[model samples]
Target: MSVESTETNPLRALSPQDLRAHAAEALTRARERSVALTSVDDEDLVRQHSKLMSPLVWDLAHIGSQEELWLVRDVGGREALRPDIDDIYDAFQHARADRPALPLLGPEEARKYVREVREKSFDILETVPLQGRRLTEDAFAFGMITQHEQQHDETMLATHQLRKGDPVLHAPAPPSSRSGPLPAEVFVPGGAFTMGTSAEPWALDNERPAHEVAVEAFFIDTAPVTCGAYAEFLDSGGYEDPRWWSERGWAYRSEHGIDAPRFWKREQDGWWRTRFGVYEKVPAAEPVVHVSFHEAEAYAAWAGRRLPTEPEWEKAARFDPATGRSRRFPWGDEEPTPDHANLGQRHLRPAEVGAYPAGVSPLGVHQLIGDVWEWTSSGFEAYPGFAAFPYKEYSEVFFGGDYRILRGGSFGTDAAAIRGTFRNWDHPIRRQIFSGFRCARDARPSEVA
Candidate 1:
């Protein structure tokens, strides 16, 4: 919350009503997420779906407690609604595997809690002006909370995928691939481009202090590596080949006995994938998901290429050669819509690579904003002059090589939590997350545009 740049306010220009509306919509989305996955009995909600994720009940109340912490107590200057229960919802205090043992609010009580918090948060939304403090500036705290909830929504969705119960959630299948020949790779004539955001109102602290980076010209997959391409790799023993993998990646692959992407099963005819308990033939045209950073890197090496660095990914996603400027999204500064990206849990799976032509980046990199979180080669690190705002846990503490950065976002990610510069990170061995990658290779001098 320190003094920032002399940038004009992105939120101050917004009317109080617009802020209220945005806040309300976020709350509604939170509720929908709750209802969508937690519709089952209380036992199911309380049961830990995976060792890596908390029970549904914990996520529900945690979402409410966060809203209350930031909006009600911090912004509204109101007293705590239930200070005694704060310890129960403290995420840092308990790991996911240990959360089920804690005394948690049941599904009914958790729902009531979020509803009450939402009402009070709306009251604060009406009166709170766009203040200059980095926490409150540009209505960032509100934006942060919205993004937090939406992010948890994605986490809960992943948890649901791990459950063994009957399918409860549903969505229409993604649109089929557009009929045409798709280029295997697209050339990017890279140069210095602005990388991150300085003035975006809702942008998180990690994506700040926009800086310039010079990347060498390279070629990248026109879209994500498809299931068909990955199946070919698996058939060719990509897992068995040590030459294609890094030291750490090869170790993980051997220890886990991972021969193919998660959720894939070998059938007599072909590979079958389980999506929310429904078994079907793996869609070859769609991007292969549920693979870890190690798998992505291995795939890149196998293809005689490499994973794009975070800067390269950003360049391909945001850099505009004609204008020599970076846009807020792949398309432009405009907010996302159904036609633009496959976000907000609209589809249960990724659309085929050729889909979302409108959402392509300036250089014709398709589906850069959504489908699967595209894994990058860079480790998580802070930009130059990066400052922690609101709290350190949001970004500061995790700045190191342990976590690899993932750009774009998955089909389950909400519009609130994504932008061109927005980043997501995780351990290289974790494949439960919806992730995929495209390859990159150094461009020849003549290939540079």
Candidate 2:
């Protein structure tokens, strides 16, 4: 697989060679993730009914099934390699908890299936024209399948985190913060800005048809709230205080006996949390992660602030006051590099807060692109003129107030799949994903100075 430069403008048309290169790289990444799973035994791979995740084998086969559906049948106009297996891998058809009960393909079978589909898919890629129908036009179908596989790779990584075993994955620690003492928050002088992407070629349906949104000036945290800051809230009886939580959040907390972020426990001398299979003292200076939206809200309320609305978050991330245009990323149009942000699983954990000055937004917000997904106040909804793409299950079914939006990507996120315009959503109570948040407040005349 070859490395391609970041599409400075994702909207532009790519040559056939460029599309093929992108497809090859995507397959390489998916294969690498699958190889990582081999470190665990078959028993671990087939384990089912784990909290909030599916059997690893299911994901493995599902990756191949999806590729066959899109690249082989849909794009290539070829017959289904295995029509009977489609029902088994349909994500919407089976819940995660129920997947283990079904007759899932074993590890070896799953590997063979994925390999076969990938071989066929590459053959299709070599011959398929990069123009004509909407799916083939600009090779959207291939790009979509690549992103789907990468997204599942992230899910598989999360499964590794939830699995009970010795650590099988390793990466060097992120660089320490070069930032000195800075203001706790920055004021975003709000105005109208383009909130979504209309031109981004591979952008999903929900992010399509960019529209202008007017926003009120708001004060937002300079960086994600750190573990140290969250610890302060916990020490102040944050979980115990109903005043700090919403009615629903309070009830959920009581029902679950939830106190601190998931995986956290207070040791006799200090706080510690499990990472992969290892336990270590919680790093105070790092951005607090594995938090739910409810926890983030309670922390914001405790601090006399609130979670930024999705628009506010976008403004902070992409708005350039000088150019009056939203850049592809907080830093600029350049693709994410190690120097730009802690992305692509280069590091297993978030770098310290206030790190990655190069990745900071024009408004001085730090670590806005990676480290952890920051929860916002807005719920998932369709943009103006929204239309479902090749399928409705991708984004249409999930549109509603049920899921809160999270911006930025986590350390495990593939850079190819994340952009400033990218939006992630989940139930407010989900804590397993690498999530954290920063506080925001409506800008007041007195506070602006």
The global C-alpha lDDT for each of the candidates, from Candidate 1 onward, is: 0.86, 0.86
All candidates: TM-score: 0.96, 0.96
- Measured by TM-score, how close is model 2 to the native structure? 0.96
lDDT of 2 by residue, 334-432 (tens): 778888898877888999986798899998999988899999999999898989997898888999958999999899888877888899999999988
lDDT of 2 at 372: 93
Candidate 1: clashing pairs of residues: none
Which stretches in model 2 have alpha-carbon errors above 4 Å?
1-14, 447-449
On residues 144-247, what C-alpha lDDT tens digit does candidate 1 reach at each position? 89899889889999988888867888999888766366788888886788888787778888998788789989988899999999999988989899999999
Alpha-carbon error at 120 in model 2, in Å? Answer: 0.9
**Residue 18 of model 1: what lDDT?**
75
Local error of candidate 2 at residue 70 (angstroms):
0.5
